[model samples]
Target chain A: MEQGQTMRGADAVIKVLAAHGTTTVFGYPGGAIMPIYDALYGSEVDHLLSRHEQGAAFAALGYARASGKTGVCFATSGPGATNLVTSLADALLDSIPVVAITGQVASAVVGTDAFQEIDVLGMSLAVTKHSFMVRSIDELVPTLYKAFEVAASGRPGPVLVDIPKDIQLAEMQYQTPLQALETPVVETISNLEQAKQLIRASKAPILYVGGGVGMAGAVEQLRDFAKQTGMPSVATLKGLGAMDKENPLYLGLLGMHGSKAGNLAVQASDLLLVVGARFDDRVTGRLDSFASKAKVVHLDIDAAELGKLRAPDVAITEDLREVLPALSMTLDIEPWKAEVAALKAEHEFNYNHPGSLVFAPRMLRTLADKLPEDSVVSCDVGQHQMWVAQHMWFRRPEDHLSSSGLGTMGFGLPSGIGAQVARPDAKVVVVSGDGSIMMNIQELTTIKRRKLPVKILLLDNQKLGMVKQWQHLFFEERFSETDLSDNPDFVTLASAFDIPGKQISTAEEVEPALDEMLNSEGPYFLHVAIDDAFNVWPLVPPGASNSDMIETLEKE
Target chain B: MMIHALELELHQRPEVLERILRVARHRGFKIIKMNMRSTSDVDATMELEVDSERTVDLLSNQLTKLVDVTQCRVLSSTQTAQTASL
Candidate 1:
């Protein structure tokens, strides 16, 4: 620590990020952020310039999802900062750890509506875990460190820091990383014995796993807890990879598109061991009717989420990593396990369409079987996202990343690039809908330039499939603005980017096309044209409870 | 619903009050009355009356986690703390 040393605020931003062990950042540079880019020129940290600020933000989200680290992004003021709003909201809802840095207008013209001036801090307050608008150069160092801490701490989510231009240019005595601030620790509760007692007393207990298990790095503990208690476990959409798909104790995804067994098990449970999951409306369906038979023991890191939805018989606020193992030490519920097994055997997810048409779910299952064990799949929202969730076999939660909470379109491509960059050794795949692919199609240039070996599987049905299905079921098929019949040939579009691609329109072509894409060297795209009339089954219609989901289309 | 009053002492940084207000709003509490007086160049004391269906402890615990907040406590409440009935 040199006593007389001084550095520009922009340089300090880079230094602080490096000190926090951030190796790469996904972002775009603009007028206000130029000073920071200049500081980044010769730095060891990698700056990946994305095609758009939205892409940069989603890519950082992908990086965070793939590698359990805080993702970083930077953008200039006004439009650049505004572009990141959707990403921030996406991260906030899904609980992804991201730190977004935006350069604001100089302090003098902050409220004068100067060129490229918008209040980034004011706009981002509701969407971020925490936000800081640095008013002085002296506050920069502490604010930077605080931003990282808040983003990565308990119940992780995005945090934003808006640095005005004056602060970036002002030179000040640089300070080292501040003494580690008090991160929110889920206070170690003394209710473990009470929770264990309730578990031991219950006959039909089900372990409900959520995204918090993955965020806490407690995948193994979750599995062990379920096994030791002999309780069947079900996962929310974001909690998909927390348990092995093939594990007998685990049921497939549970929510709007949850499996029959998964939903039925919840209905029959007498005790619900809810771990690391907030019971969202999608999962709960009709709030009043959800898990009506069960007494819940809710465990979460955030106290706010504990009793927000369903009242718990015992609410323990602690990390799942600590809570799961502690409570599972001596539970023996063979009878509950037997009941869960019976339900699983009777109501397992089945894909018997009785036709040769290339069904999206079956195709996804086939692709899942061929993918490498450590492969990462980033999916865009719509029917394809639900199909992948219902079919894909993830060994761990990190293997699958998607905008689960926000359900944002166009998240797959940039997210794939970020995932590939984060884990070079692992295979990366992007599953996107035709509509979603067009949203951020320019990211193909980024993939080509970086030479990332990302496989893009575009499920093209010539329509916004999910919206069309909803219209058919709820609006008497008066589909409005859901048609995309005039879409360009996807393979030709990929070719223009100098990326090799192939299109499959039949069931027979599915396996070979997937194999070709997976085996190919650098970035490859596969356009699979499937039936536009297809609908995701087991849909819980609007206002219907999870238990009342329509298992067959005829019921709708 | 009950009325709860909180007295907070905190470092006077940007968004300090906004952050506290945000938490108050999130906990389904309406700020009925507020009074702020500076304690020092960098510190300030705030008194707030919140209308809430939730308990005072829930609001106080979340407020304690804020970075700028040095201290927060429940000054008074209209109702006695209730035990979990379920």
Candidate 2:
């Protein structure tokens, strides 16, 4: 390549991705996006073809979440682009850094109801952090750079770049644009002093952690703060691995399906040192009664989140890495710690079931204990998701990838594929339910194609367990379309994709089957049949305070 | 209903107005009146009068997050305003 060489816009798109160190992208090719796919043909950048565009985008999200790098995905116009909306929205809510490139119709035919053309930029406005429709070839390179920047910048989220067919075909001179350096925002000393004063003055202060800690790479600082303050802590669903789970004072997850000890501690706390977390409705059951006695000291990178739901006594919208270290101080509150410990002991999870049928929670706990240090658990939504959150422990926030904000059903398999692609040597596992596995089950072929050593643990209740539970409790047992009793034989289905699997229903087979799944060289699915009578316990009924959680209706 | 007036400076783009209005509507602020003029080829200024029971900071804070919005400020806010008879 010469200094002033002209290349196709599509070629420049691939070049820009390589320039940003994007080694692998997940996407599906189509009519409008064929040019970019053509450019990706022999380039250094590799593309993993997904069965569906939605799967491709979710895989990109999993890659980004796993590696802390901006994930890239590609799609064509109309249906291809529409399929990406849910994943993009998921990324936006969870604040994952992803850049989705969609190929639009030719510029002249954009608004004339052209074939395979939809208003992608217009459609993207609600789902993405920012979006661009390249009107000319000259703006192609710069727009790609900007897209990457916006995706990875402050409070990162997904960004979309819609390129018209004409722009991809046009030739343009290749030149690297000057990059702009972003100035970091520094916290004020006065705000730090004010927050410290609140922490020092309180006798029952607790640390409320969220996903932002890992997103900001401030997990170490947060751990230090928790250690120094000696404060009991409760984590949101996304905040699970930010704090060391081994810490006695760390009372696992807090919120809807949270531990009784965790929710009670929050309700009784006098001060909440909220770090990198929002007061989401799910976390704050009835906003007026949630932490009714606690004064909040909120810290996050996004200003809008500071006072979005619960107004803070001291709001610091600076990087958590700086703020957490600055506010670390030894506290003189031992009585509160003892009380929280008592609560934890009083409400510990019981694993004593009389039946011979396999127990999902107990099985998940066993699976967690057997997982190696270098393992990632990607789970789908519903009863299995909550069970994983309750039973499994993670080494870091990246080690546990669940669609926290969106709670999308078909997230586990594709995300597991992306995680395996990102960390080739890691023991990546997908924990999905009978209802969720079928959503993106086509990706089993992806694992076979790559021969990736990813493991699948499918818990089969033969029904949409979560929905059926809700129907029993709230809707008078008028179960509406939640049954999945006729589910296909999962082992046979996996075998069709050249992946070996086994099905087990007895409690006696749990341990050996888990060991078999974990030790297998290639992909293996372990489908365990469980009773639908089991439901996620300790649920904070809708519109009720977190402290008013329904313990359980039917005893196992 | 409460009436609030806001002043905003935005980057000149084809869809900047749509972005601002969409955010305002989504955040529970209704645009009652709006005036806009180009400050330059690349910049535009808008004065928006909105009606909402929610506080002005809620709308201003969200509006400030938009990439196209350069600056957003609350000009005035008044409670006890009657609903517009449009």
Candidate 3:
């Protein structure tokens, strides 16, 4: 080998990563990963400088989910690495693909009380699909290839790769793998006859699709199968944008604050074909009553997910992209389409306002209508998210972005940064609750520095609305410690970042506020005050059937 | 035919996940899983269902002493196998 051709461990890591087609990475630089940063300088990978390590991880996640590829992110040792745990857990739960790279202490200094040293691999165990540490420089390329493969394989999820300081400083041959080791599908159910027979035997068929289906690129096949079966189709919040909101057969999102029609359809259905969905609690109001009328037909890529919750009458384990087409070929649903559509129409969402003080739902609808048809909106977990899912119409698929799987509080602001980075052409907005916003408030710096147009709509209810509702329903009407009277002025907070903010109080102000934000040259933050007593509606009581939802509080 | 679990204690930090899975995938451990929780009183348990006892011991003894991790052990499953065993 030529003398100048040789490189150190960190340089090798960068070279190998570039070989794997990584162009963008989000991370922060520090003591342990300085070698990596040096290696990345003047390299192919364009690293987005993040204000915090947590924001970096989430930005990578947003990139991975939107592009359907493995997202790459980097962080320093200890706190830098630990900050990525929440985003990794979020990606793992929802099966979004990401590869988080972290630096570690030197080999000799590992066990000693080394500064900035931490076991990144240990802390992220439950949250990642797979993780690794590069002991020797020779293992760099193989480990990186494996990390990407694990992140993008069947049942996609986050994978973490930790590089030790000594390893990053070592020198070795940097040969990138020509191809990744494809993880073979473990289990499959090819008996289309069984699935078809089960579908044929049931009277009311309800299709429950989750983010898995969307991630599997089975949206078209899922819609076709639902159309052919002539069943009511409902999606989880992560599964939103999979079905058109206006489709006659579409039942809208299901679970807490899920459209009444969608939940009723699930309860009334005799046959439930839950494809690639993990019936999360937010989607299943009452676990016992979810699809009570239906004999479930579970179709998913992961074998472990099959009987995890409700037992399936027919468990067909295979890629939904492949199995769906095969099933559709054998069944004909032209005759039953109209009847299913009519049934779906009955359960549609309705929000007829009676001249209230600040109708939040209408604001969402107006935003939905006014925004560019392809604009993407992500929300933090709260009442506002449910309200948007119910009332806002998403024209394009994969347009609405919210932390549905992990339900992380501070996910919106950072993830909005990611969303903006991923699709610079599309307008990205974040609808956050007062509580949720304060969690990741530091990310405001990211927007200011990057100059990314992420319009933030902060809903200030001065309370933890969702918890308040739960306490009201199950806690004997006692509101408990959910109230939040002392809160930062959002307009002032936005001003701190040198970004403009507007204080909006009524639905009448929504359009003008949106116009001001869009027309503005820089990022804008809008704080809209909402009534505290307003509860997220259409809730299913515990252990009740999907049909039995408490739309409004029982007249006590 | 041994059902064992191990407790791996690393600096309550992130990159340790890579070290654990690296060893697992390297050694070809069939089903290795870990769960995380805030630990003030008890241990953070890392469990593995390996195919052989030698592999289990090697993993447990070698990895338990890693820098950030505090404790590593092999635990047995409480639930008896109902279906045909793997």
Candidate 1 C-alpha lDDT tens digits along A492-526? 99999889999888887878888999999998999
lDDT of each: 0.87, 0.92, 0.76
Kindly list the per-residue Cα lDDT of model 3 for residues A1-556, writing each as its tens digit: 1223577888877776676676678899999999999999988888888888988888887776666667789999999998899999998887888989899998788868699877776676667887787776777878887787768877888988888888888877656556735556535547678988887766567778788777888888877776665566888887887876555778777876777777766776777788888777767766776776678888877765666567777887677877887766333454444555665566554556655456788788877888886577878888888888887877544677777778888888887788777777878888899999988788898888888888898888999988887888899879888889899888998999988888988766768887887666668898999888777777777766667777788442
> Residues A1-556, candidate 2, lDDT per residue (tens digit)?
2445689999999999999989899999999999999999999998999999999999999999889999999999999999999999999999999999999999988899999999998899889999998989989999999999989988899999999998999999998888876764574644888998999999999999999999999999989888888999999989999999888999999999999999999999999999889998889999999898999999988888877888899988777888888999998999999999999999999988778899888999888889898889999999999999998889899999999999999999999999999999999999999999999999998898889899999999989989999899999999999999899989999999999999999999999999999999999999998988999988999999999999999844
Positional deviation of residue A201's Cα in model 3 after best superposition, in angstroms? 3.5
Q: Write the per-residue lDDT of candidate 1 for residues B1-86, one digit (tens) a residue.
A: 68889999998876788888888998778888999877888999999998777777778877886767899988888963653232
For candidate 2, lDDT tens digit of each residue in B1-86? Answer: 88999999999888888888889988988898999989999999999999987888889988998888999999998885466553
Candidates by lDDT, descending order? 2, 1, 3
Off by over 4 Å in 2: A1-3, A182-190, B83-86
RMSD in Å for model 2: 1.5
Better of 2 and 3 by lDDT: 2
Off by over 4 Å in 1: A1-5, A181-188, A330-332, A554-556, B1-4, B22-29, B51-66, B69-86
Quote the positional error of residue A177 for candidate 1 in Å.
3.0
Question: lDDT of model 2 at residue B54?
Answer: 83
Clashing pairs in 1: none
Model number with the top TM-score: 2
